[model samples]
Target: MSEIERLDLLEKTLGRILVAIGAADAKVAQLFAISTGMLGFEATIIAEIHSFSCFTFLFLALSALPLLFSLFSLFMVLYPRLDGPESVIYFYKIARKDIDCYLKQVGGITNSELMDDYARQSHRNAEIASAKFAWLRKANMSLFFATIPWLIVVLIGYAAV
Candidate 1:
């Protein structure tokens, strides 16, 4: 295949990866929302339980600990990290420059340079996606752990009322 064909394929691959990142981020956000709601529900239950017994506190701690950890993990997935120097293909960096400067830089780059940039950007984005998925896994694990205690909290809460 020609270099141009290779470049096109690389560009498409990079775009697909970017879209996957966005989808993963959306999933993490949804999980964060669910965990937050669970925490709020637990807090409300704890609040309503006016008779603060040791068992009440124990169960609340058990349920809330993993929930808080899940939230933290979810937040980590959303957190932005600025690693390495910006590339010509990095839209954020490109947009920061004056229009003339951006045009000049783009006009000056050869097809080979642009392809190199795309390859580098693709690798960087892949690394970012991997990190996000790892965080997502941690968040999922913690959320699952929280549900076990949460069910107990629900039982105790219903009995108290």
Candidate 2:
């Protein structure tokens, strides 16, 4: 594919990544809200658990692992956004005079080497972001699956009592 096409694809990919990040952020926010609400109902939960068998408490404790894992995953998802790829201005400032020379070589006088370097840098950032998203997805799944044990305990405990 042409360099332009590749760049276009990269840009599109970046856009999609941003959207995914936003959606993930929203979901995480919801999780936090729900978790916080649960906190408000903590007394009720504890009261319920108080009457249950030791097994119920054990399962309740086990449920925390997934919550922790999901939290770790949330941080992974935020890592890229928190410490984003170097900005063009930052690169320009760091590279100093090299930026001018790079710009001069643009258009018909394209500096293919410099272009490739920029592309490489973008690709690296994209890869990291994509990987983070993968972890975030896994974390989300973990968060979901974590509820199962808690539900099982609650149902069984209720039936037992």
Candidate 3:
């Protein structure tokens, strides 16, 4: 009805969207890890079934699928959105300002409690950002390291075959 109510609804909707994105990201990462691990097991099975030298290259190439996916996810996370860095900065600033305005309008009694609440909300936001950054960094590193050995395996397999 009011501008404040609309802003509050928008904030709530954004929060839900972010939560869904985060959940999807986690699920994707987990699936990738499981798939890669399964590929490693498959390679071991193939090595036991056939000569290690003969199939090594094929196995290596196969293992690269999950690694590539990890790199792709990392790129998605790191790529700047259409909104841009300035937009993100502005969004947070606006969010904090909105919260402050809401608190003042509500006529909170205690200064200490209001400050504490603000600090808690800020900390939560920081933690969310930190977690997202960490996930992206780890994914990138995993892909980078995995690629080298994967390439080596492909080369070795090709030479042997």
Candidate 4:
């Protein structure tokens, strides 16, 4: 097929992948929310039964919900850039020599320049995507570390009561 056709196919495939990633992310977020909510309810019940301060349970619940949500949001924001469109664009540029040659042979000057510009844009997009991915990773790691303390607090409270 022609270069244009190939690029079009790539774009379509990238779009589908992005949509699928989005759907998966949404499902994960929903499940995380539900689990966190259930855990909060259980903790609340335990605290009430033990006659401990309900504020402890409330604090745990309040913190857990937002932490889980933030993780989901981080994944959503980074997934597309890291694994979807930006990745595809990066690959496309790697194979761009063939595309440029093909366009030149076909006497497609305007199309050629457009593709060149797209490749450049893709490079910039990939860089930004990489930075975002790094940020998300750091955030995730921080959340993981934070969870340890939260879990310990809950466990201690439970053991005491």
Candidate 5:
């Protein structure tokens, strides 16, 4: 491929990685909202079951533990980790420079250097996106498991009332 075509390919790959990261972030936000709502829901249910029998309490604990774990996993997904080797394409690295310096450095880079930057950014971002997705999976699974015990707790709560 010509140098120009190779550059275009690298740009496309980087764009795809960035889009994947954006989707992962959006998923994390949605999961966060669900976790928040679940926490509020559990609080109300726990309050209603104030006179909890041992079974009720047991199920509540089971329900709560997984929910908390899911929330923690969601937090892991949202946590930012921007540390990496310096590159023109890495947001933090770029942001660390003053406007003139950033403009000069990016502007001064040759086609080959620009390709290197894009490739490094693509790899780094792919790693980040992969980790976020793994966390998202864990969060999703924990949330699902939480509902199972939570259902039992809710049913018992209703029976008690």
Candidate 6:
């Protein structure tokens, strides 16, 4: 395809990827908040229960450990996002600088070469971003499943007490 067409496609791809990243980041944040809040509440309940009975506290602690781990896994889920694909930003920065240089080149040349390079880098960055998100997505799913046992434990612990 022509440079202009390629650039257009690259821009669209970048936009879509950025949107996905934003959505996933928001979701991770939301789930983290919920998990932390629930964990906090459970800890408080266990503390209160402990005041009344050592046996109950021990039982609840046993049950709550997985939930705590689940929450830990949830925290782990954010690592990819925190690390994110630096290549994308790097490519964009390079492209911006190249673009400026291209504009200043002699004879008002429309540098299709740099545009091609930009397109290539953008495509590469998009791929890297996708792979990163795929891993993040898996981690998020694992976190979701992990919470199930925690919930069950919480319910059973409360019931037992």
For 27-132, candidate 2 gives per-residue lDDT tens digits of 6666655544433343345556546677776776666567667777767766644343443422433464465664654433444544454565556556665776
Please list the C-alpha lDDT of all candidates, in the order they appear. 0.85, 0.59, 0.53, 0.53, 0.84, 0.55
| Model 3 agreement with the true structure over 135-154: per-residue lDDT tens digits | 66666566655665665664
Give one digit per residue, the lDDT tens place, for model 6 in 43-130: 7655444334565555455545644655565455445433222232343443545665644642353446545544655566466566
| Model 1 stretches astray by more than 4 angstroms | none
lDDT of 2 at 145: 72
When sorted by lDDT, best at the front, the candidate numbers are 1, 5, 2, 6, 3, 4
lDDT winner between 5 and 6, please give it: 5
Q: Which consecutive 10 residues in model 6 have the weakest lDDT in total?
A: 80-89
**Model 1 clashes, total count:** 0
Best by lDDT: 1
TM-score of 5: 0.90
For candidate 4, lDDT tens digit of each residue in 44-113? 6456445545666565655465566556555655454423232213555345447666546446446655
For model 5, how does the per-residue alpha-carbon lDDT over 74-148 read when each residue is reduced to its tens digit?
888878978877898787998899999999998899999988888888888889889989988998998898887
Better of 1 and 6 by TM-score: 1
Per-residue lDDT value at 143 in model 6: 49
Residue ranges of candidate 2 with Cα displaced over 4 Å: 1-26, 35-44, 81-110, 153-161
Q: What are the candidates' C-alpha RMSDs? A: 1.7, 5.2, 10.5, 9.7, 1.6, 5.5
> How does residue 29 of candidate 5 score in lDDT?
72
Give all TM-scores, in the order shown.
Answer: 0.90, 0.60, 0.39, 0.42, 0.90, 0.58
Least accurate stretch of 10 residues (summed lDDT) in model 2?
Answer: 81-90
What is the TM-score (0 to 1) of candidate 1?
0.90
Candidate 4's C-alpha lDDT?
A: 0.53
Judging by TM-score, tell me the better candidate of 2 and 5: 5
- In lDDT terms, how accurate is model 1? 0.85
